[model samples]
Target: MNELAFTSWTESTWVGFDTETTGVNPNEDLLVTASLVLLAEGVKGDLSQVETANWLADPGVEIPEVAAQVHGISTEQARAEGRPLGEVCGEVAERIVDLWRSGAILVGFNLAYDIRILEHSLEVCGLTSLEERAGGYGPMVDPLVWDRKLEPYRRGRRNLETLCGVYEVSLDDRFHQADVDALATLGVLAAMVALYPSVRTLGREELTDYTAAAHQAWAEQFNRYLASQGRDANVEEYWP
Candidate 1:
């Protein structure tokens, strides 16, 4: 019989991406180091993640001390080892577009920040924006958003490390390294879908829409909380 078999989410190949940037603000930040992992599904239903590429960009400006403290890359180091900004940006853009063209979903922790910053980098380099290249940010799967949906009541700083603990996955590597974090994020996603197998049934588009909706609701509630405390917050109500 000719058949269309149902494959779980892990059956699909994923491009895991992460960046250690100059700052938290995507608009002002410059890429410091970035890594992309192409995770292929193994024959035994395991993952085989290969580090496809890594980049260090000469941002043409000093990386702030606060940011360096977080990612452990000093401005002096970047100047010594990083490539020209335009060249690095162009290469990264091409890589992302290639992934999209190949129909691989992008995965990361707090991925909207990374996507926005990458888009900003491309535009600043006078290359095509993400929208122009891939039609729009889509088919992205963020473990951060998924965790909030699966465990809404669990509280207190759900950073990448914390999520790893919740998923019972050990992140043995040093945190804040782009390559390590990207690989860890891929593990986290696999763990999530394994625990909540129903979620794995959703198609790529379905998952993206579901994540956007959840983020929108979360943003509304968080904005209201900020108003209660006389503060202003406008976190975007969507992810890549």
Candidate 2:
């Protein structure tokens, strides 16, 4: 495989990943659904060159009403239709590792959450973590980080749906489904590269370092603001 670099991102393979979980906490929550949407080289927005893999896990716990309302996956439905949690976690981890080994850049919106959840799930299942398997977590692109860095003053929600709107990317499907979110993330990234020459020009390692530093800077500023308001704040200073 050719060396992975951001300069040729449009002609490189990308794997957009997303997960829908039972709750908001990565440490306590369980993954209910996960998806990987692959956009091959020279095929941005071309469905014909895309491939996808999706999974639903039984989770081994009740899918809370709030989470079910968000993702439309009831516990009863999951128990009946989903695969075992260990099986799902192992498959998802291995598939992601395989893609990384094949030189695909991972793309997501707020990917750190998903990556942490996956890491927790693998530990729970007694399986190897993604980092152990892949030797590292990235080459990755997080549209959330880039959007915040590029347009810091544009203040509204930066969630996936809002980003799709901001970037003029279509989100034709429902919001919380893992597959739909993954595809929407890819669309947003494609739009970002087209609009921001800086994003298009960075090399792979350079972009990784840039985003990591950017996230740390944002975390520090946010923490200071929270401290001024007398609120407890400890936003993570790492990137995915």
Best by lDDT: 2
Instruction: Quote the positional error of residue 212 for candidate 1 in Å.
Output: 1.4
lDDT per residue for candidate 2 within 1-240, as digits (tens), equals: 133234665557888899999999988788899999998872244634579999999999999999999999999999999999899999998898888777788888898899888888888888898999888775777889888888989988989888898878766668899988888898888878777777777776675677777788888888999989999887877776
Each prediction's whole-model lDDT (CA): 0.78, 0.83
Supply every candidate's count of residue pairs whose N, Cα or C atoms clash at under 3 angstroms.
0, 0
RMSD of 2: 3.3
lDDT of 2 at 228: 94
- How do all models score by TM-score? 0.90, 0.93
Evaluated against the true structure, the overall lDDT of model 2 is: 0.83
